[model samples]
Target: MSKRTIDYYTKIGILTPERSESNYRFYGEDSIETLHLVSQCKEQNMPLAEIKEKISLYYTSSVEKEKLLKYAQVLSKRMEHLEAELKEIKPLLDALNEEEQKSIINRMSPQSMALAQSLIILFN
Candidate 1:
C-alpha cells in the first residue's frame, strides 16, 4: 500500500502504526493483515465507513479476539528473540551428538517444551 494511503488510514484510526522517537511510523503484521482485510472489503464494493465499522466489529465483538491478538503479538516478539538466540547457538547444537541433543531436550522444563511446540505450530 502507498504511504499516503497508510497515513490516511492512520488518521482515521483504522490502521494504527507504532511511532518512533523520530516520529516515523512502523507498521507490523497486524497492520498488513488489516490492509488485506480493507482490500477484500473494498473488492466487495463496501464503503470505507462500513469497512471501518466491520473492522471495528471484528476486533471489538469478542474479548477472546483481543486477548488472542495480544498473545500473538507477544509470541511474535518472543519468536524473533528466540530465533536470534538459536542462530547464535546453532553451530554448537549441530556439533552435539544425538544423545547430547536428547539429553538437552530432557533437561528442558515441560512448559518450555510446550512453548517451543506452540511457536512451531503457530508459525507453520
Candidate 2:
C-alpha cells in the first residue's frame, strides 16, 4: 500500500501504523485487520460515524466476544430487513428488461433508489 493510503486510514482512526527508528510507518497485523474491516464496512455502505462508534466500542470493552455478538445481532437485523425488501422488490426488478430498469432507476429519487442499485450490484 502507498503512504497516502496508510495516511488515509490513520486519519480515519481505522489504523495506527507504528513508525520505525527512521520514521518509516510499519503496519502490524492488527492494523491490517482493522483496515480490512473498515473497508468492508464502507463497501456495505455503513455510516462512518457508526463504524467509528463500533471501533471505539471494540477497543474500550473488556468482553470482546459479547460486543462482537451484539454487533452480529445488529448486522443480522439489517440483513433481514434487506432480505424483506429484496423479496418485495425482486419481482419489480425482474419484470423490467435492462433498458427499462435503467429508465426506472433514473426516475427514482436518490435516497429511495440507491440501495436497490447497490443490491443489484452486490447480487450480480
Candidate 3:
C-alpha cells in the first residue's frame, strides 16, 4: 500500500494506529483485519466511503454472501450492456467486406468476438 492510502485511511478514521516511542505508528490486530477487509472491498471496485460505511456497520473480516451477490450484479448489468452494444454493431458488420469483417474480428478479444458471433447466430 502507498503512504497516501494509509494516510487517507488514518485521516478518515477508518484505520487507527498508536504512536510508538520513536513516533512510528503501530497498528494492532484489529487494524490489520480492517486493512484486509478494505483491500477486499477495493478489489471489488467499492468506493472508499461505501467501504468505510460497510466496515463501520459490519466490523467483520469476511464479506457476506449477500454483499458478494450484490457486487456480482454489476457484472451482470455490464454484460447486458455489452450484449446490446454488440447487437447494434451487427448491422454495421454486414456493410463491411469479408476481409474487413475478419480484420475487425481479429481486433476484438476472442471472448468478445465469440459474443458477437453468438448474437449474430441468435438473431439470424
Deviation in angstroms for 54 in model 2? 3.6
Q: After superposition, how far is residue 65 of candidate 2 from its true place, in Å?
A: 11
lDDT of 1 by residue, 20-117 (tens): 99998899988898999999878656677767766776677565666557656754775787766666776897799999989988998888779666
What TM-score, computed on C-alpha atoms, does each candidate reach?
0.47, 0.51, 0.46
lDDT, model 2, position 27: 87
lDDT of 2 by residue, 25-112 (tens): 8888878777677777787788776676577666674757776788788777876788678878789888989999889778978865
Q: Using alpha carbons, what is the TM-score of model 2?
A: 0.51
Pairs with backbone N, CA or C atoms under 3 Å apart (clashes), candidate 2:
none
What tens-digit string does per-residue lDDT give for candidate 3 at 1-124? 8888888899998998999999999889988899999998886577787677767656646777776676567557755776787678778988999999889878988776687677667656
For model 3, the run of ten residues with the poorest summed lDDT: 70-79
| Candidate 1, pairs of clashing residues | none
